[model samples]
Target: MASSRCTQKYAVGSPASSKASPLPSFHRFLTKVIQMNQLHTPKASRNQETGRLSFMAPVSPPRSGEAARGGLSRRNARRVKQSAPAFISSPCTFPTVLALKKIAFTVTSAALLSTFVVSPASAVDKDASANRPKPPAGMSRVGGELLGRTGTQVKLGVGAPVLPKDLTGRSWIVADAENGEVLAAHNPHWRLPPASTLKMLFADTVMPGLQPKTQTYTVQEKDLADLGEGSSLVGVKEHLSYTVHDLWLGVFLRSGNDAVHVLSSMYGGIPKTVADMQAHAEELQALDTKVVSPDGYDAPDQVSSAYDLTLFARSGLQKADFREYCSTAEADFPGAKKKNGKRETFKIQNTNRLLTGADGVDPYKGIAGVKNGYTTHAGNTFTGVAERNGKVLLVTVMNPSSKEPHAVYKEAADLLDWGFAASGKVTPVGELVPPRSASTGTGTGKGPAAAREEDKGKNGPSHNTEAVAAEGDGGGGGGVGIALGIAGGVLALLAGGVFLVNRRWPLPDLVRRLPRR
Candidate 1:
């Protein structure tokens, strides 16, 4: 057998070319065998077959005068020669069995690594999905199973007025503000665009941190940026200063995106405001709501249910300021200051037709302020609370099918009328459950009536009847149990997968095993 000499070179930084340590004895021996086989093989044959060692082999430099025939330049060829490893000598014979064995080992190692490495990432994703609370299905049975049902749900006693025949809202709810009982509902848990009605939640979240009369912010150009095209505006002007009271008036009265943006900017920015609003919604147990824009502009995935909107109204009414702002039919908003330094003012009226009787809509008797919203997509959505005699009722209507203008207000008013007439004549379909913290004894979960009773005991009667009627028990849903159940199942599956993988591969380094009995 004639002996042949060959030299292998690797890229400067590749693992094969690394000078950190000499190759293991088995790898060195395999390298020598593969190089000898390559030296004897024809150039075309070598190109056609990709042996395991081909990646480690350097191209052979051309013989004398070959460089002049369109090969590497003299300087580059010299560098390649200098970088080449020491020459090896061996007989030319292909080690077919050994090469096949190495290739099989390489493929097996890759598969094992991928199984262990990628599985944990996939498991993490599954765990995250399992941990997030789902709406309607996974949410707490706040008002029992009746509120969670799909269609109309109500319990009418003998002679109780039938639900308004013309009610067409996709989702509607009627509940007693006194005892937290749901009087009637239709698709209460159906999530739909809430439009400006979501502003009620926004107000409940940001209002506490601000002092309407004391805290004032000068509007900046940046405050008005990204307000969504054709959004409702209260004509908020940049470079002008307005008290928080004026901004809120603009919000409740005009359903103004400009005022919303300015208020959100005062808190932090839109991102922070959105995050806070989301947190507040979760706390309120408004599980069906997903807040994408603080202003409630039509955006992807932003939705709320009639059940949740009613909860927002009930929570908001607990505060006196919220009651005052929502009920005010009209207010003067601050405008540009004149040259003489007196600030100009303009009148803005509430868009809630049931409150102001605007747009040919009749004002509901004893109607207190809540919120109303409309968008091309949302159509019309409203949540209102009203009092009759000494009893208070809350009603929410969303997305009526009728094309007539002011249909939402008409439907809500009808529902309110039915709720008052049905009082004491019908059993509640479900009761609004108090907030998780309240029911769990961690916070005050009392609705308006309970709070009023407490106040009467201490202060001897609440003379403010409007405040008393607007107030309602603050309650929300809880989904921790559902989330935990899903998480536990996922973890069980993960453990079983690990056990099977360990039985086959035996990762002693990662998972220690007990001794067999």
Candidate 2:
């Protein structure tokens, strides 16, 4: 019944001829039917009715701003309204059948074209990060675990697996001159005599700045006067002259105390030189270490921990020239000619047993030129770099007893073996609490009472609430807080996207308000 009424309301009719002009009223009714059909017929039949209207008379101009109100403000609405036959149709009474078919095809083609148009270009970033190489085995083991534990909420991955309990003794640490993250430490805070290993720091202060070939120093009366010295010495006579480079070879290779004093005095007066050594130590942030003598001699105040000694040795080895000097097993300082001066020649030997194959350390097998030091106070200290299968490991041992220097080596080997077994992998937890802005607060884990005392004492930076829980607090508020923050950030972003979609297109009301014509 509704369809019948629609057809009557939007009538379709044949055109009246001039021969029928005698019935002008009938002709008028026929004309009105054609106009109604042109205005209100279904879109599929409108083209034919449009042709009849065009043949009968000219088209009227559309109302100003009517098109804007009808649809163009919205993309989908504009598509529906623009394609309506009244908007673009040309009237032709004969061949209306063909026009209707053409209009149907045009509408179908427009919809399909919209679906198949090329999609917008998406942003694509090349992942150059994957090309980076893995860190060394020792790094994989130590820094991996520590960084993983601290930054796990970021979800990087778990750190290369390591037995943390196995990492307890033997004095371990993870330090980088770059980041300064001492990821793991054992007995790092303790101070002990550094023994001969202290020479590495002595070499660090001297080697880089020396014009080795040009600078020459004469052995002072006091420097060479002490004969039959129990400590390491490069025997030289009083008033004997040597180049700075030659003295460096002796101090580095033979662990020569005799040559160390000569270099120290030549670089600056003894007092100023010793101050520089202390200053260098401060620069490296090796606080527990104090150097009373340039050589790693047994002075009452000269002390360093295993960690600090490693830090000192690391600084020296980082220099290409320093490593060349220390790595040399033997060197011959040229003898003075009789015409030039009295002939004085000496063969300096490397003291590091690991390189010499002494005390069961075999460099051929693995160990590299690192210094060894021993004193009554410091039993035996060793630091060296070992390379195997493209993996380099740095090991430092402090005060292993005379009977147990090899045992320290064995333990280092074990760490290397275990470290390589775990590939370079680490998981970083996101910030437990967002890193407090330095502008707002210091992240010191101190309480208010402690902070007040620090402020009053004028010792250093004050303690603050930002201090995180102590290391090894397996389950703490910091850990829980970090996990929750990451989850919250992800959820919030998802909700925002959904809200934007709903705001852009509210469709249900538009469909319900479509008016019946």
Candidate 3:
């Protein structure tokens, strides 16, 4: 009986030990499953596009070492005693995928930063294009011609073609003084009489050389001879004398032919003055201009084109002294000395209808000094400048209708209105240089057969020459043809004009009028 009891006790103890041993095997199997799953779980490719991570069905409970398989039944029995929640509590094996997502986000963030940094460089280039100039077509050749022929050194680019066919007259040209771009053209190469408008060039060139004080000059018999009885005059008496400065004032303010001769002679004779004028014109390359007379009296060989005239006007306006002269609507020339040396003060007024507001034309709002010219050859020509809203414009109207100066002024206003409209309309024409007609009479000299004894002293000196012959004297415009010539635009005195409009902004309406090509 004692031996049997001992054997039973040993068997019970063995069962308890076996049951406890299963617990360690289950723990080891769980650890092995985690390691295997970690090894087998796929790592996403580095190049994968960004987004969310999707999970594959939970990987097959990884095949375990044999011990794990063997313990499952015992563990299941034990787990059945415990709660099911406690057994299922480990991480779902998704941490590795989470790590991969973080890495992708970091890479995506870096790529986004790089893209933002490089974008602005392209935008700056686009902004630069807006302010760049467009080349006007046919401009290069015109520029070359201006530089080569007239000494007007205008340089230009291709913007729009300026067709010559649309123009009228022997030659025609339109330019924007503010912008300096030639808008339309015809036979711009031809040279014709610039007439009295040439005086503007003389005034502009000589004003700087003047000493401005106490420079004395004498009036000669030649100065007073055969001055048209009815034509305008400063009443300079022969053998009388005046300061050189006053003579210039008279020449510019009154358009005095006598003062012109006196001044021209004082400036080293007409030839030297003419040469100087020509050289200056050459310097500017004003090719079509030939300055034979400082007064711009209707010399047959002296001629200028519409284009060259614009250049001349532009070049002259640059001088302050020149501006003072033409701008003077009224001035006092301390009287001419009589042959007996008596002094008398005389008032000289500018004949430019625009300056004096003599004609019906409305005065330009901000107009400064300029000259007016009319001759049988060059009818109703004007070179003018005006400023408004901090912008300056130089304009030239050559051979507009003599019957109406207002017509020309109105046309000029139209151009002015157009220029103010845009930023890019008129290109500057080189440098701004702001810068006359005649007739004969019916009366004969008061001397000869019935020479009136009282008239001899009152009517001034008498000459016996035929009145027509006297009327046709020096620097005077050819007569009889003006009225007839005006009727036919084909004649030398055609009623056409040229205008130059320039500004900082493109001229408004300028583009609308440009040639289609």
Candidate 4:
């Protein structure tokens, strides 16, 4: 038979004539071979004169030799059994080579596409790692390892109720106040603004030094000078003398920044009060807190975590005065002196809605007291201590996203309910670790014992009703730190792989083409 003619033209002496023309011929031959193999065309389909194959005709039964061999004829079987080198070099073998090339192209494209798809995820991971908050210097995780984790942490037993799904707080923790067993938590270590809740630490630290009934502070213009705009105040008048008891009432009942400032001044000054609060926090092992303002006013870097706030609540409640002040729903604040040389007083109610049950909010049963706080930056934060059936639970909720009035109190109430129900039914996720001095033998001169003694001297014997429990010294160690490092390393590797893939196949145009939200 005459060989088929090549009708296609290529430029003379061009690279296409030497290389490109053969590719098309090879491709066409492979395509036809593939069609023939798939269709299994009958022998009648081949033209006897040209010896050319056609695949559109009907298939035929295998010949006797092909049937014996299961598929191929004897001649074709011999060709298949030939050595690899000869088969590869033969023109009839181009189909196998083309098939392999197609597979290689497909695999390579798929791998490239996979890298492209994964690069954005890697970049996002790297960015998250870069932006993740670092723990305070030399500050260990006071709570257990589970508290260090980012999402919800819980260990339910056979009959424990699930945590409330409607909880929208950025960070929260429910724990036993007496035993310091953390029942459950969500983002417990996330450090955010604490608003006025930091006052628990402030009051815990400085309240011991000043005798509430014996000491009196005369409010000065400078005492209230640094008050933040729109600060809650208990109506402290300049040049009026207020007993330390009255100032604390203002702090707890009204969340009064003016009262906080005057007390801070009496505690030395705002700077000294802040420093003392920081030192007290470290002693309590509230490692996630950074106290910039004594009144928990929104200041730069003034942050605390749910875990730390719970620590504050637990520690503050151990003191008789702190407990009495926080639990007090309403109290009389000294007002301007009456004309008859008598000082009248105005009523100030506790800002903690769960305690006061004012403003249409139902009072949480068994509610004792801790504190609630709010600021534009901190949103709403609360830490409540409640007792039920001899089981006291401490719940701290921070930055709940709901805009409803008193949402923080509602969430705290819900968590408290869940905690009470789950008590003894769920295994503790972590422990509210003891103060630094409590673990170590060293005396910080500001330990719980010293605070207790100070409380005894100031508040007398009968007021010291609750005893501070001894906490175990178990440390969370370097587990969380190591996990963070590993995460960063994994993100780094992903970022590097993405960089290499982008170097080989640039994706700037493709990335730019992505539709904006």
lDDT of 2: 0.44
TM-score of 1: 0.59
Candidates in order, TM-scores: namely 0.59, 0.49, 0.48, 0.60
lDDT against the true structure, per candidate, is 0.61, 0.44, 0.45, 0.61
Per-residue alpha-carbon lDDT of model 3 for 16-36, expressed as tens digits?
A: 332322324534644565445
Where does the lowest 10-residue lDDT sum fall in candidate 2? 45-54
In model 3, which runs have C-alpha deviations exceeding 4 angstroms?
A: 1-179, 183-190, 223-232, 336-342, 401-406, 426-517
Ranking by TM-score: 4, 1, 2, 3
Q: Candidates sorted by lDDT, descending order?
A: 4, 1, 3, 2
Residue 443 of model 1 has an lDDT of 22
| Clash count for each candidate, listed in order shown | 5, 16, 58, 0
lDDT tens per residue, model 4, 259-365: 89998888899899989899989877676788998988778898988888887876666556776788787677799998998899877677777776666778777
RMSD of 2: 34.5
